[model samples]
Target: MESGNTITIACAASKRTSLHGLDNIAAEGSEGYDNLINLVEDLHSMNVINSEESKELTNSIISKLKEEFNKDLDDSIIKIENWGAHIVRTINQDSWRLERLGSLLQGQGIIIMDWAMKFLPQRFREKQTD
Candidate 1:
């Protein structure tokens, strides 16, 4: 499969995995915010939604959860860096895929790397270079 298709498939698979977690988390009262964040991050990483869409969805969910629990919940914005980290984590988890993707990108590796590096956590970036 082409690299772009591979990425899409990987991202879709990741989303499916996360959605299962989300289903479980959603059952708990007021304790699922973190999982919600992960869902949003995964959605954004998958390109299934844009930043604005993520933000809107987050706010909507938070509102619903608050109404259900009749308690205040912290509003969250879509963290692009977290999304970046999620993508990196996904890639790192499969070394063979990373190699294939790198080869697929070819001359564009530097540009993609530069963009990804900017948003990755400092600790992750440090570990990568070590």
Candidate 2:
């Protein structure tokens, strides 16, 4: 029937959209992870953080990001009857966690980068003034 065909088409479209959404999230997370790594490495280079501490911080962040990404992907899958209702329910349940994880990464990246920038420059200035 035409209605059945239309329903199938809509479902397919929704699925594609969902996949694209997940891809977007993955890309954003990847960028955040990269920024975190760069910030830590820069701190190490500036002697602001030692090698062991930098290594541990980097590994912990990478692991947490991977875990969160997998969890978010799993959570976003549509498995129930009503597509709209299911999406709403998933968003209500999971969006806060996802947003929090993202904000944590983003916020930390900004904070660390700011501190590293200032700390290194201030140290250089102190040396010159000495």
Which number leads on lDDT? 2
Q: List model 2 lDDT by residue over 1-130, tens digit each.
A: 1345665344433322344444644555565666688899999999999999999999998899779867866776543336788679768756765665677744363222344446776867764224
The TM-score between candidate 1 and the true structure equals 0.30
**CA lDDT scores, all candidates in order:** 0.59, 0.65
TM per prediction: 0.30, 0.41
- Give the per-residue lDDT of model 1 (tens digit) for 14-75: 32234433543333433455468678989999999999999998898878866854432222
Candidate 1's C-alpha runs over 4 A off are: 1-27, 71-130
> Clash pairs of candidate 1?
none
> Local error of candidate 2 at 47, Å?
1.3
lDDT for predicted candidate 1 compared with the true structure: 0.59
